[model samples]
Target: MRRQRPIRLQHGTSLHAIVLATAMTFSGASALQAREAGSAETSDTQVRLPENAEIQLAPVLVEGQERSAGQYTATVFTGAEIEDLGLFNSEDVLRMTPGVNINSSGGTNLSSVFIRGVGSMYLSDVTDFMVPMVIDGAPINARHISLGTLDVDRMEILKGPQGTLSGPWGLAGAVDITTRKPTRTFEGYGRAEYGEQGQALLEAAIGGPLTDTLSGRLAVRYSQSEHWVTNDADGAPMANPSNFALRGQIFWDGKQGTTALVTVEHEDVNALPNLLVLMPYGRKPSVDLTPGLYDDVGKSLNRYALEVNHDLASSRITSISSYMNASNMEIAAYDRKIMQAQSGYPSEFWNQDNGRESFFTQDLRLSSLPGDTITWAAGLFFQHMDASYDTPRNTYGYTSPRFRDFKSNVYAIYGDVTYPVTSALRLTLGLRQNWSSTDYDASFWRGGVGSFDSRAMSESATTGRAMLSYDLTPGTVLHARYARGFAPGGYNMYAAQIADGEPFGGATNDMIEIGFASESEDKTFALTGAAYVNWVSNNHLLAYDSGTYVSSVVNADTRSQGFELQGRWRVGGGLELAAGLSYVDARITSSVFGPSDGDILSGNLVPDVSPWSALVSASYETALPPFLGLSSPMLKSIASYSYVGPRPANPQNSLDLAAYHKLDIHVGVAQDKTEIYVRASNLLDDMYDLYGYAVPAANMAYGGMARGRTFVAGISHRF
Candidate 1:
């Protein structure tokens, strides 16, 4: 079907300016309040309110803690806050997190998450360079981490090296998501929504008692959307995406000290590849070209997990076991007609990639109960994964087929201890030892002949952390820490093009950081800030060799330093405000494959590393007067703005991405058991590039475009 052009809304420029100015003004007011409150010396007991008039706020927890008083440098978002922001998926949630960036080439399943300018530059069945993602205590693959957050209880983003606690694959950071558990009371909610471009959504969840000692919960969601882009060649829709997911969970509270929980989930996704528009000399095209063909890419996943906990006299023991299976298939036009348009190629080529992967993991931990002077935890972890990829291509009467198989095993032991040296001072120490091995096998067939080769490699590393924290005053704390992280290396599947039995070496990072956190006596204002410097040795870098149509992984040295600030304020009346700002300086210190062998590229900005980013948001809620013989209803509205600075697109720092800004707004009304809302995103309908890659041989370049203005309306009911 032909897609219609979006209507450009007016008054966006004025609204944007107003939002920025208002945020700045409120920020200044909050800072002044902080200063006034800090002038007087007060005991920590003075911050507590009277028992009768005390107001309870949502608790701040990070991945299983009752509160995040002084554990680590992190950010926590509750489910209610996520819903208020209208962020229902992983992509949107990560984009709003501080110091994080996400880029999707063409499909949500093919997205990459970068933290502190560290992530994989290419996607493959055997690559594991991105930030690790954990859902319900089970680790998930990077390609399959775009699951919906509809039923999440809380999300915790731990910044910097977490190797000692999360094992490998956390060299940059880690994201842990906890799903809502079954409730003892009977309750459920259902919602439906309609939006532009033929978008429709349906979601429902229910949880209640099934038996005396057993409770169960089930949730399902489905969504479909028409293409937002138009194809000029045939005047048809360019891309359409849809997905369905279902989850079931059961909980058993057995004896006094025993508890168990089990969960199973399945998800399926089908979508068209991202729209690719050719650009020459970094200029947008007046008109988009037509693709020679179109095909759908599909992915399916199944996951299962079991967790058990037993309380001892002075400690608790826990165990977690998980399994996952996933498959993906794609068939599409490889050239997208860019070759024909720019290089006069006779015809476009076709390509296919079919792959599958399986994962098994187990973790055991024992932790001492809370103590007056000391607390400690120790754990053992194990994981095994296998993956296979097959690729077939036909270009101008030449056919080539390739296949690769990969297997990996990981083992680790870690421990951490915290002790209070004084009433206001605390110290912590942690260490981890990891051992990993990988085996890779590949084969290629051409002219009715094939050859095969196999290679294996193993590595070991020890990483640790040391920290000190002190309370400056009531509701204020200052901390400093030193940490180390590691990421295991592996072989490139395209063994035919590289040296025999050669593999990339593991990478390591060392960091030193200082930070502070403070909250107002009334809990109406909060602020957290951090500054850190990191040096990485043997940094893994992916480079494309245009001459050979192959990609290679290499090691180099790099450095990154940055500071981040986040704040929240609850002004008088019904107004609330939040804001975040980050600045980073990341560069390559040395590399061997530069303009010449052993050339130094010191001071060159790293690819995809934005130097500056900021976010500001406001929300208001109040009761409305009675109308139409109905009781008072509540009205709520929220607005948010985000800015991302420009960055280098390649290693040479030749091509650059332009800075961009986005705005989102939501308004709703609620009465008793019913609620209605309307949401608008990208209010300005701004057009910008999310990512760009060059095809030098075809004298062409293509990129992914940011989404334009979109609107949605929805209503829901609760019992």
Candidate 2:
């Protein structure tokens, strides 16, 4: 892991010129619909209220949703239901939300993403990195997006500590994505799918009217799968020959109001698999150990964005600009006795790795357009980043050469205001000011293991937020919030192996949230609940050495509490349901080694947290009229179930982890354009292991293997 390059935050555009002239005069307002003459009756409605009444909500809309760790934020899957769940990235739709967690070592290569439990394991620099990653609307820099799950039109996961409007590193949450625009009529769509072990996929999209003011959209996707780890170390069967994506967009409706939008994207990924440990702890998994499998890992990413909108009358102006570049080269190696037995895993080392990232972002906003009882918004944000990490340790037998540089720059100014005072109470205020600078450089092996410099360091902070909402009626809502979020600190390249030699610092947090929500009507039953607590300071931890697993990055202080519940239901007619639940109580209250320090490793437990997690979904759709070739619409069915618990991979938590479950099924058939599909994931052949590690006596177990149930089919067509 290595990075060093950052300094960006560009804001200008006459302060978003009244939201780019009110998005060019409302850009047709999606076809300006407001005719209620004889009730032509379209679709889309909500209002049920009765789960103990007193709710008045509706004033939150973005793309992408599922955020709760205190500060309520919800949108629960959309973007065409996350591309119909044929997930290929973005941790497979953020592991189904609620508390979020993902640690991988599968055929898709190696994956990592965690929330609530805090992530960036075994240190090497990457302390929450503000968790900011925005596509479509810019802002993306976190070592060139190791996050996946593409083909989106929505994905908003804005949990706690978002630092007023997504600034200040977003603290511990922020995953917003929106892709799918540019449509002037001539619509189009396509899809081809196949599932089980030899997964395959193809996707397409088209736009319309390239004139009348300009409008365009293009999308492409291709995927492949195989490799279920039948290697036995070298028996053959490690697949992932391809995965690709290409996207394009164009929109301009200029005239006096003005509006311009542009976007571009590309992605390529290839992989071999490894890491499926799960022995005693989770009970089953770990078919056979294959030390250091994953012979190849490649990643490529490039993105561009430009947005401008202006509309003044009561206020509305927006501006966003972005750029991203990413690179990954990994040739792995494992099995140091499967990580020295375990007990804190981390063995000597092996390598041939190179990671690079480049990012830039700009955001500007001005708001007002929903009543006048007092509502406001102000914004300015900038980011710049450049990263690098190179590893080397072996050759002749294959590979070595290491280097790392981490550079950064961020600037921000934010504002928020809301007031109602009586009509059922409502008051919200927010503020944010952040300035940061960091520079880190390192060189080794090919560079003769000689360089290491830090020098440049600058930090400024200011954050605030207050909330209170009570609207006991028009739906239902009860909310309470008090906020102070922070996460910005860096420098840790293993922090000199456990801090002894001292070299690693940066970490912070403080948050509080309370919530409640309810809904009915077309939304079919909705409920939300929240409870949270967190206080972390200078907490950049990653100790270890007990059995000599070799790990370091210290600066400890921690506290966490949690509760969250998300929902959606229909349960009738064609059936529809969605659910999420999470509970956590992370600990270590105070550390630098205290609470009876066992070799200075306190209360333990907190490695890859998972106090509890859950998800359940059911779907169904039907339409048939035209016959044979299916002139118009047709079949759709989906099923899902996921559960995770039992976590403790280290921190001397003794040993824990023994809960797992998964089941997925999908079936599709459509018309009016084209479609075809089939899927079955981990059905019954339920041997599981999400991830694990061990060292010392050399214990190794990584399992979550299920390529056992397989079958596939595909087809697609469009204008």
Candidate 3:
């Protein structure tokens, strides 16, 4: 885990004296290392962990190859770990990582993936994510990062600001997911599952050789579930979810040291989770919704991509081209009683939104090959996006419609170089130059207010990072870094007036991080600790009007500081212990507060973020009896405990969520290619808020709590 600077670890220049550095370099590949430790040919400068180690670090990709094990900064999950943990989506996997938290406002909006207590914090139909999620060398909005994950080879979550190499929406960091490629040998697998509330899932995949130099893989998954909270309005299951996805990939191993891959994918999702229960007062939790209301949302996506990697005498060249399209529709209801701490009259309103978006991106890069003393990678990137939105609403029996045509373009050059100062010391420098433009035209009826068109917004920013790493011992390392990240600002189409869009400004963040990673000589113990601080200005924040049910975007200044510690221990026998802790202090440093608009004050904790989070998990494996009638039978079990501190629910500090903890246990029995397991969720049956917000003037706090106590049984097999 990586964290803000602890002020104790420094090299050369004073940590606080870190200037706007230049020439930071990187070539990421997080695959496991088969070579001995301290090998110069190793692409991963982090820790080289043993196979049985507990915690995983982010991958370091060098010359199209992956190197795994520990990174002083970042986290990683290999394909095997994904299956073992039964991780199905971004939330599932990220929950196990330290210093990462997932918060949602509920609905079709994408969940905010917060790192070190910093995130977009608010989600609406038209909002864009501040973090970049890379899939198969293609950069898309953080949309699919939480949608689904299938046939993935590895996942790497780099903490803090990763603006230099992966440039789009780098205000936070980056999440890179590499899908499994077709192999020369035939291999396939199937899985089926059933859970509480009529939950069911089916998934399958197959890949094999199609020709002497070509191979193909195809995978599909379908899942559906009933809402945990029943809708008393119509005695129906509201917030039900149904999702389907398909992917086909082809890989070619051609001429001398050359490889190419092509991928096509499609996905459809339907669900809107803004459902809330009816709890009139300080009574017991009543899991029933208001009368005459429901939530519905649908999203569809299609993606096509091509990637080529060619090896040169001393370097590797990569070219990637990708195009994707997505469409979303949402018809959801809002309750005026939301966040009402005291019982009051029930008020209801509903709105609908329909939109389509398309994105095209191209990237070319050259990097050092293995065995090179100096590691470096440079790339040129270009991206174009076109989107259209149609939002029609009916609040208090009044009709309002809004339309927007939006376009965005980006161009950039970024590179990183890593040089070993000596056999035990290293310095890295990375730099990125980016230019972006956003244009949008809006047409609408803002109820009593008039509508207007949007203005053009263009901005240029230079981002870079400098890292200094020194070996404390052969198995220990200390590192400190300085990084800057940026995101272009744009019009908030959902705004009621043109003033909110005419001269919007972008957001920028600068950070300093220091941490260390250490491994036991015998490769049985590993630990990582980090600390970091961020300085941000002109950042977008969610502004809501409880009366109009309109959510706006406003610019604000904030500061976030945090620290993390994670470790793994492999005791004797087949038992392992893993634990991690994170603490973030995020607050609004300065902002123009408005009573009816943003409605937030300085010194308030950023809404929806918890200051303290912790995780503890244990795993064990043992042989099964011969009476099972299967060869090499094994039984495995894992138990996890997570704790989240109380968090402010809204900007006004009117609503606060109580502290909560969740315990889960999973046990499985395996024989050859097949495994059967049962998982218990929320073993403690703890009920807590999923999303919360303050009413315009309700002066009361209210929100929905997650369902308690559920179980799922599943079977997986590989063929």
Clashes of 3: 34
Best by TM-score: 1
lDDT tens readout by residue for model 2, 1-719: 11111111111123243343333222211100111011112123332222321111111122111111113354335554455445556666676665766655553324445567654444345334645555655655333334455556556666666655433345556566666787779876777776666677877888887898999988888777766654344555544557788888899988667788888888877774444333442322233334334546677777888888887888768788887777766654443334444534644343456677777878887766444556666788888887766554443332324455778887888887767787777778788988877786664343334534444566777877788877676556677776666656666543222123244455656677777676664456666777777676665655555343335556666676888876655554444555667888776655354212133244555666778877665555556578776666666556556666767654445444455555555566766445566666644444445555443233333334334445566665656
- Clashes in candidate 2: how many? 69
2 or 3, greater by lDDT: 3
- TM-score for predicted model 3 compared with the true structure: 0.86
Tens digits of per-residue lDDT, candidate 3, 142-251, equal: 64554678888777676766645433446777677778889998998998999887778899999999999999999999988876665545676666778898999999
List per-prediction Cα lDDT, in the order shown.
0.66, 0.56, 0.66
- Candidate 1 lDDT, tens digit per residue, 584-615? 88888875544211222556676667889776
Steric overlap count per candidate? 0, 69, 34
Q: Candidate 2 — which residues are off by over 4 angstroms?
A: 1-70, 75-90, 95-125, 132-156, 159-235, 239-351, 354-390, 394-400, 403-420, 429-441, 447-456, 466-518, 521-574, 577-679, 682-719
Which scores greater on TM-score, model 1 or model 3? 1
Question: If the candidates were sorted by their TM-score against the true structure, best first, what order would they fall in?
Answer: 1, 3, 2
Displacement of the residue 290 alpha carbon in candidate 3, Å:
8.8
User: Lowest summed-lDDT stretch of 10 residues in model 1?
Assistant: 31-40
